[model samples]
Target: MGKEQEKEVILEQMEERAVEEISTHDAEKSIEEKLVAVQEEIAGYQDKMLRAAAEFDNYKKRMERDRNAAMKYAGEHILREILPVVDNLERALNQGVVSGVDAEMKLAALLEGVQLTLKSLLAVLEKFEVKAIESVGLPFDPNIQEALVMEPSDVVPASHVLGEFEKGYYYKDRLLRVAKVIVSSGKAAS
Candidate 1:
């Protein structure tokens, strides 16, 4: 080849190489920018996830604290209801020893006060779903009645409750106390 032709060919090859290098550098820069943007996006999502998890944890703790507080004070209302009964008994005792009242009158007043207190207490218990179980004249039930004695009674049939020593009670459909009862064993032996 001639020297000038060789020079021209060499110049064309150099220009082509320069263009290819610039294109490769530009591609590398673009890829780097895309990678940085994707990393920033991922970091933002990670921050949001961390915050959400922390908030959920805080919410759970708050609920547990509330539940514990509720449990701690669960009997507060019932105790409050019973306080007045105590107060009434105190008043009755104080009145029983007054200087002007006679002994019989004082006793009557004390008994009346006690009856009223009992009625009030029973009302409170009923409000809380407690009730008395009627055992007398009803059939004896081992589930709710405990027989203390077997009596012969013409009035009450066999296997029936003749009397209750201590009355039974129910609290919200459940037997709170079993009745101590006298069960009839049928009519007296002829």
Candidate 2:
């Protein structure tokens, strides 16, 4: 009712409104700061996931390349071993044709060279798990021996191997070649 009282009442109401506005602004600022922190944490996790995926892809490609290289060179070692055998054979043939050597002496030297070369080849084969099969004086086996002819013999019993035209061979427990052989029929008629 009085002018001074009315003025005091208006000042108190304005002060209360200012206090409410300041409190609301502070609450809004705190919420904004929390949202920024959460967004940064999410970005860091995404970066780590991307890096892990790239590393896994690189590992798979490297393994595939190594496997292909291994397959390509699988038989390189075996071919290297056989090259020396071929060289030895070439030398033996060349020695057989040397001029001024006596015919008998040349023949003996050639034969010796061939025998040595054969021994060396056999050694190489053995190193790779290849072995010769013995057929002479044993019972004829159709599984491993091919009968070239039937012959009558007193020394070899019926159904036995008379002789081998070509020897059989085994490579790692499996038959590589069959023996070409003569099989005994029975004793000859008097």
Candidate 3:
């Protein structure tokens, strides 16, 4: 081969090598750009997951707060209903003492005042859905009455309530207290 031809062959080989290197470099750059885009998409998903977790935490806290409040005020309605009865009793007692009447006169006057106060208290209790459990002369019910004692009696039937020591009350169908009562044990009158 001649010298010029050999030099021309060498130059052509160099040009081809340059073109291949350029093409490989362009492929590497495209791959790098795709990697960056995928990373950005993953970051967006991570942010969304964090936001959802925070929202769920807030909802749980709110529910807990509401539950605590409900428990704290569970008997508020019942207490509010009974306040007026206490006030009426206080007023009756104060008025009876202030009159300064004789013992017999005072006793009669106080008795009447107490009856009226009791009636007013009953009215208030009824308005708030509180009802007195009828324990006297009725069959013993464990749910509404607690038997304090059983006694031989000529009144009513055996196992029936003869008297109530303390009144039982119901608030809106829920039992507030059980009545302390005496039950009858059938025996002939002496």
Best by TM-score: 1
> Which ranking of candidates, highest TM-score first?
1, 2, 3
Q: Write the per-residue lDDT of candidate 2 for residues 14-105, one digit (tens) a residue.
A: 88888888888888888888889989989999999999999999999999899999899988988999888899988888888999999898
Error of 3 at 117 (Å): 3.8
Q: Which one wins on lDDT?
A: 1
* Winner of 1 and 2 under TM-score: 1
lDDT tens readout by residue for model 1, 50-166 = 999999999999999999999999999999999999988998888799999899999999999898899889989999999999999999999999999999999999999999899
User: lDDT at 152 for candidate 3?
Assistant: 85
Residue-level lDDT of model 3, residues 76-98, one tens digit each, is 98788778778877876776676
Q: Note the Cα lDDT for every prediction shown.
A: 0.95, 0.92, 0.88
- The better-scoring model by TM-score among 2 and 3 is 2
Ranking by lDDT: 1, 2, 3
Steric clash pairs (candidate 1): none
lDDT of 1: 0.95
Query: Worst ten-residue run, lDDT, model 1?
Result: 86-95
